[model samples]
Target: MENTKSRKQPSTVFAVVSFIAIVAVLIIMINLGVNTTLSVFAGVIMAVIVTALLGIPWKETEKNIISVAADCMPTFLIVIMVGMLVGIWMASGTVPSLMYYGMQIISPKILVPLAFVLCGLTSEFTGTSFGSVATMGLAMVGIASTTSIPIPLVVGAIVSGAWLGDKMSPLSDTTNLASGVSKVGLYDHIHSMMYTTLPAGIVALILFTIAGLHYGGNMDTAQQQLIMNTLADNFHISLILILPCILVILISVFRLPSLLGMGLAVVISTIFGLVFQGVGFVQLMDYAFNGFSIKTGVAIVDPMLNRGGVLSMSELLVTFMIASVMGAIITTSGILDVLAKNVLLKFIKNKSILVLVTLIYCYIVNFLTAGGQTVAIIVTEQTFETTYKDMNISRRVLSRTLEDAGTLSAPIVPWGVATIYVMGVLGCSNAYIPYAWFIFIVPIFSMVCAITGIGMWDADEKPLRTKKA
Candidate 1:
């Protein structure tokens, strides 16, 4: 038995080492200005190395690769559809009308907080940070350009609001994933997160509001009106466009599947486009694939409103592929397992340390994976479930930590899926935004709550009794 274990250990170590080397090479290539396509190739190589090193039967790894590919196929279709939806919506005047109204309400003095609230509302309704950013959040960027606000800060506020809603909303995939992985009830997880999420959101709003009042500069009303008029010329703007968004919110509130809810919204938007804008089938198809382009002959407005389509999903696809493959390799190599055994388990002796360590580990996993928020929550929950139980801590606490750290941190990491999508739509860099104040503050605030036992259930709580029994 000892010899068998020893043989396995070497394979695991070799697998981890090889995976790390590939990642390092990819990083170097990226630093050296190699195209993103090459970076994805590097990730694929790393995945193969991990499969080989895991000592799984060679045929099995090949099968797994096929499975992974198959699983990813639907994502491609969804991405394409999303692109088309965005394009049609833009060309149909849905987006422009929304933007026109948004611009009328927002001035530089209130842009930051207003953006936060708007993004927050949209994300909650959409249940997808990516969808919200791609649609309305993109419009916010155009609106911001008419003001003297710092672009990055505006981007940050948008990110902050979107992620906050995504983390807290019952409809969010990450929220469900955290609860599911931890074996906690969905409502319980959401209720627990409110302790941290609400405080952080309030703080973020206050900070953004202050910044808007003090640092936000004047707006060019002429330029803003010009952009609005250009939008009016292309598509029919009406209150009817608001129905799709409202339908999304209603479906989400009923706890419907996120994909279904989003798909419904897409259908509504398409119908609205066809009926109101006289959009042809060919045009709709073209818009979805190539994105909507507005030829206003005005350089700035064209670029701003002329983006959306399956093609826009390219950067996001690459980012997801890289991060997912890396995560798969990490799982296969047992490096993550070893880290949890050696590092995470060691914290079980101290209640406070265990919570702190779990929070930190979840945060690091999110940063490294840069994939979906679900990946971090699942990994962290699996890593620490036994420890939490052993320490008599509630799983809800763990679930809460997962949200506060993992779910909220995705948008701050440049290569992360949310960040890449947001940046692509906004036409900015991830680094452009100051680290979202909410993202930075939420985890710290949550850790404080955990250590001080502020929001934690009492040891004698009924849930603990049921769990222990």
Candidate 2:
């Protein structure tokens, strides 16, 4: 009893210490105006210190550290590959062609909402937010600049749409990861998500439409046409560029592994680059490593288009490392267990409180770790598995909660991977966007569904009941 009590005490101490440290770092980060990467690194270091001081075995802690690193490797590799693919696609005129056509169809009044809709379509088809952002999203930035619309608003629309598609699309890696982690069927998961996702999307569209109607008339047609023409002249725009996008969509619709599908798309793009764009073997290699650049003699255009490379992976990697380590510490030291038992579960009684508390906890975890949506889902799954099971809630309920809070809220947090990347690409400050309707609305919508018991099913509540043993 003495030894067991001693162990419990250290665990309790560690939980308290880590929680305090995390709060302190959040306050300091806010005061200092530090970016998410720095804040996450500080939190991780503090967590490690707390864990050590509380007597977590060094070997056990080290194992978790290594596991975090290994789990993150696929993301790092995907980031690098995506960067290279973007570079090549840009150089080959694939993205430019799509943009040229997109610009022709867009009117100033519909630009903002259209940006959302278009990005949503592309991300759905491609099953990649990063790929959509690199290609057509970059074009939208140019279009937004020409139209005098706020960049952050445009970025918000883009992110909102991109993530919407990511959540719904069968091909998205995160979508697969979420379902896989929850042990839910892919179709069932996608279907279940729609209850929350569709409403959020509709709300987002309405908001973007209203904003567009107010700001669309101020767009400069001459400048927009000029940008389109410049893109057209720089790269060979044609019907063929659409093929790679189609291939991506088809593969995704079939629900193949995302890596394999994306790899196939890359191969198709490379072939097109060689045959139609006259890209040489040497240039192809360079584009994959260093990214593609267009010397358009236009200063803004050059920088806007000349991005994406293997080197771009470093910053994201650093942020992930810090966030993952912090998460590892939090889990290993039993901080989450303590919080779940003493605070969250204690206060959560019925479905309303359950949903709200889960949402709050998921968001807090996402904010503290600065990790992506996948990490958020992983944490929530582990943290709430028992609670959810005990409450007789279907795993889909937890999955829905994860997406509503974790996936949608990621882009709003300044330090989160989605927010940071969008800001970097669009050159928009996080605070400039007054309203992110989708991010704000999805959680509310999800909770309402939960409270009403519209989408939830108790484990034993199924119609085709199993016989008792």
Candidate 3:
């Protein structure tokens, strides 16, 4: 901790100025079509310059950077594995089966609501919104195109379902990061989130139900026939193909490690790919690293299937590294805390305001940092843990807030990795943002709960902060 001793804390004014400048630069560059990776690099350069001007030694900054990166390494691995899971599952026809069967079952009358719920379940099982969107979401979009329902509405249902699943899933990297960073157990974190998630999910479903009823109609039978035929021609759609999904659910039900479960699913899918899909072992390996390619003559379906592989996640990984470096540099300079103490915490004395501030902080991090949920969680937890302790708030509450904002907000921010990936996969525009019902509801519900102390630990409970309590 000698490095900690060597750093000089900048005044609140300097800290605020530095933050605004960095955020402004990032936003301008991103909007100008500069790559998000480059924007993060620019932010890091600014952060380092601030540290140097503050007289903090570069070695101390290096140590902080390494420490934060080390903390994030597990999340990186999980995300990479999630990429592989998508690749293997898609190649194995597990995902294809799900899409085919899902399309076959849902009638136009209940399409929107069921699509939302189905995508949610798929994402919850897969633990990645990107994966859910690339597969199930793509299928929904393709199916919706043949109907009179608005594409934005369909995209909205898909995003709403996918993000909600990502928020609650035990296998989700964001969920794990939030809980781990906040020193809460994984199951405990998910359980706590249900208070807000369940209510918001129900509300979202109701809205979707109303939308489906209004927009529901008979889609072109010829178009639906062609899509189903393409899926059948390409994949060996069968009940057995659903096992991988079942395996993931069982793993989560039994409280197993997500890495293990996702890895197992990948292995099983790989074997299935070889045995059923006739994908060779060498090809399977290629698909795991480089992703699966679909050559179906159908235009709408090909893009949806053209996803997965470790390489596909390269952009996200680079974004993660760059943002982590920026966060580390700012943290090392001690500006993050100074700004937090003087600017954020100055007026946040009570639980209600504190909760709102935490939510806002997480959202700001997502927007400014390009929506790295793990980065947001780590930063928010580091910034707010002490405040929560002093306020007698439970860490579970902190965990829930981190997700309610950080995880949920990512898919709404146009430049966020999750949003970009989902949009790219679904081939939809930002028109869906206004329709992403669940994403908007959870945070508002969280703020309401915080103000009323609903679902929060009692202030007088001695063991309120304990994991087992």
In angstroms, how far off is 232's CA in candidate 3?
Answer: 2.1
What 10-residue stretch in candidate 1 is worst by lDDT? 460-469
Order of candidate numbers by lDDT, starting with the best: 3, 2, 1
RMSD of each: 3.8, 4.1, 4.4
Candidate 2 lDDT over 1-469, as tens digits, reads: 4433334334445565668778688658856988667887888788777766666676777798788779877766666666666777777777777667766777777888988888899888877787676656777876777776777778878888887887787778778877888888888888888888888899899999999888777867777777777877777899788777667667767777656766887788888888878889688768777777668876656765676665555576677677777777766777766766677778877766877888887787776666457667887778887887887777877777877787777777766666666665555667633556677878887876776676666765452123211
In model 2, residue pairs whose N, Cα or C atoms come closer than 3 Å (at least 3 residues apart or on different chains), thus clashing, are none
Worst 10-residue lDDT window, candidate 3: 460-469
Name the weakest run of 10 consecutive residues (lDDT summed) in model 2.
460-469
lDDT of candidate 3 over 1-469, digit per residue (tens): 7656766679999988988988888879878989867877888899888998888988778998899889868767877887787778788988778767766877887889988998899778877676567556766776676678998999999999999998888878789888898888899889889989999999999999999988877678787777778889998888799898778767766767767877888889899998889999999888888988989999967765777788877877887788778877876777667777788888886777888889988877776556767767888899999889888788889999999998898888765666656654555666788999998999888876776667677434334323212
User: Model 3 clash pairs?
Assistant: none
Off by over 4 Å in 1: 1-7, 10-27, 50-56, 63-77, 347-349, 462-469
- What residue runs in model 3 are displaced by over 4 Å at the alpha carbon? 1-7, 122-142, 148-152, 169-195, 214-218, 385-399, 420-432, 462-469
